[model samples]
Target: MSDQSALQAVIFDWAGTILDHGSRAPMGAFVKAFAAFGVNISIADARGPMGMAKRDHIRMVGQAPAVAASWEQKYGRPFGEADIDALFAAFEPLNVASVRDHADFIPGALETIAQLKARGLRIGATTGYTRPIMEELMPLAAARGYTPEITVCAGDLAAGRPSPLMMWHAMAQMGIWPAHTVVKVDDTLPGIGEGVAAGTWTVGVTLSGNMVGLSAEELAALPEAERSRLRAPAEAAMYAAGADIVIDSVADLPGAIERISASLKAGKRPGYR
Candidate 1:
């Protein structure tokens, strides 16, 4: 690797990228929270803004034309901050409880992280989860042998993913500067966008993320052709959203890092294309 191109750190997203295979927990919490207000949404809608801060995600969902119409019809007014607050109130405890159940590390995630750490790469993390949720999750993830050196959560900053503030925080805390010296790995488009905005090499994880939303068991059970069909849209979405690379899961992350390192050696920074 070119000396200047050597990676100093790798920042990962929490839920779908690390702990929760298929990113199942948050969607359920979002659905339940909305239903509590008598507005129903499909799983796809809930997943649409999956990488945003929980409250922002709820706000985005509520602002959807169809959801907004329903809210107006039901409550005689468009959804607003109050609605988002109420939904988030319902969402937090449910999400906190559900997180433990979904905390199983994605297959090979721990091993992949271990390998990266062994190479002297500082592992930092950025998450849409708030600190309290992360407090619950960190210990669970640690038990599984996968904990980043630094973790920047949603509310820790004034803005979250797609804004780059959280990623910046991670880099600052880890003492990794010059965004090109890092890689941001995540499973959602907004997360990828955050990496792009931060000027870090961005890798999008498919199969085990919001894009495909399949548990390890569920993905393994699919025939090769069907699995490809399911993953195509999500892969394309990530690429379209500016992911420099897309891998099947955290398992494929090492290879991506190798390739990104090569590109860096060739003097290609993120967004170079």
Candidate 2:
């Protein structure tokens, strides 16, 4: 059998894989929101909740339960609910702005999708953003000539990544019934877990995007061993969470698929290792 028969669809994560540095945009929004509240948080701190629901992630970043106390300790003054609301309101604009303003197609992303489509495979997207946010992004993305055959917005459903609902829904809508016929690509642990839980083949993309914010210069500066150092954590996370294959990036997807096809042919499930 041809390798294509092993995969009927390719599911992708929107922010980081299809667009450039997905998490970085959200991180900037988080930093901006915290700065507005007089609670300074670094981008590094904001990235910790990358794949979570936006509001939930923001709440964690904002230290919601003890917002006043946390702000008092961190900023030398207590912040009121109004202050928190104002900060979150400012951050809210970023949810749509990130995709509309800076959602450039990742290098090789379109070409890869085109190649897969040529092979008769459907393409899909999953994101933590709400449906309205996705509506806002679709036009902007289309304006720039990027599109996915199917798109799953986290808030559109009851649950997000790490939950199989979004993936299952996307597959159903795309007419791909067999979970193993679809391959999910993502840079986050929850996303990988969602794919695995949905029983779809999973490929973890690790290079130059949301999973890591390595600049081209930074990536080039690292030796192969050091590069693996940067990627190992994400790989381990995805593997433990249920990824079938861990790839370096969307650029490495074709090769990764080849490897997955080989393993599947050999009758080895991806996470068995």
Candidate 3:
């Protein structure tokens, strides 16, 4: 609530930030996708490129040296476009089928978004899922009363996260200009990079995202000291990757925005501070 330009909008990343509390679906899909190609990857590898478009993410994993080596051993050739397509094909149905199961709204996500909308800030969302996956997710999320005014999926843009096109698309569709007036909330490094590339205040959500990848129940089961121990590195990684601020979850977003608003009033912008 500084005298600076009023916060205009918040662009959220779908999976971990709002729906799919722990961002679980994509990781499993990516693992299965690679397994179909005879490339076995650890969950850490699967999560490495989290927040990029699904196809792009598959391609990235396929191109990794270990995966590529596995492919070379399995098929006597390098991983290529055909492999990427096959992996994506295998991944799509599994992802689509399980998306609904993961569609539960993260606790406080709807409430936080409602609060933002009440304050007159536009709600927009961008996601790594393709339009079809979003088609599945949207109605489920809407049924829970957490629909954004604008949603731009991966296939809808020429490029996806870390490229900033999806963010730009959301801004354009919402008719919001001056990127600094916007805030981007995401759960992964690539998503943070997208916001930085777009020159917006970027807030990273830790426990609910790729970093922790823990369900609310599971996270709650951990002792307080253990939870803090688990969160520190993920927070550090996000900050090092260019997040302007990092919070525990989307529930903490309003406070992050208030702090960012103060900075905006002080003439700070992403990459300028």
Per-prediction TM-score, please? 0.97, 0.84, 0.96
Please give the TM-score that candidate 1 achieves against the real structure. 0.97
**Candidate 2, position 125, lDDT:** 85
Taking the tens digit of each residue's C-alpha lDDT, what string does model 1 give over 93-120?
9899999889998888889988998988
The lDDT for every candidate, in the order shown, is: 0.89, 0.73, 0.87
Model 2, 1-273: lDDT tens digits are: 334337678889877777755446677777777777567776666776676667666656666445446687876755555555677678777766765655677777777777777777778888876676778778777787668877888677887877899999888897776676678888777778788889888887777566677655567778999887878887777777777778777877888777776776777664666
Ranking by lDDT: 1, 3, 2
lDDT of 3 by residue, 154-202 (tens): 8886788899898988888887888899999999888999999998889
After superposing candidate 3, which stretches have Cα over 4 Å from the reference? 1-4
Error of 2 at 187 (Å): 1.0
As for candidate 2, its clashing pairs are 207-248
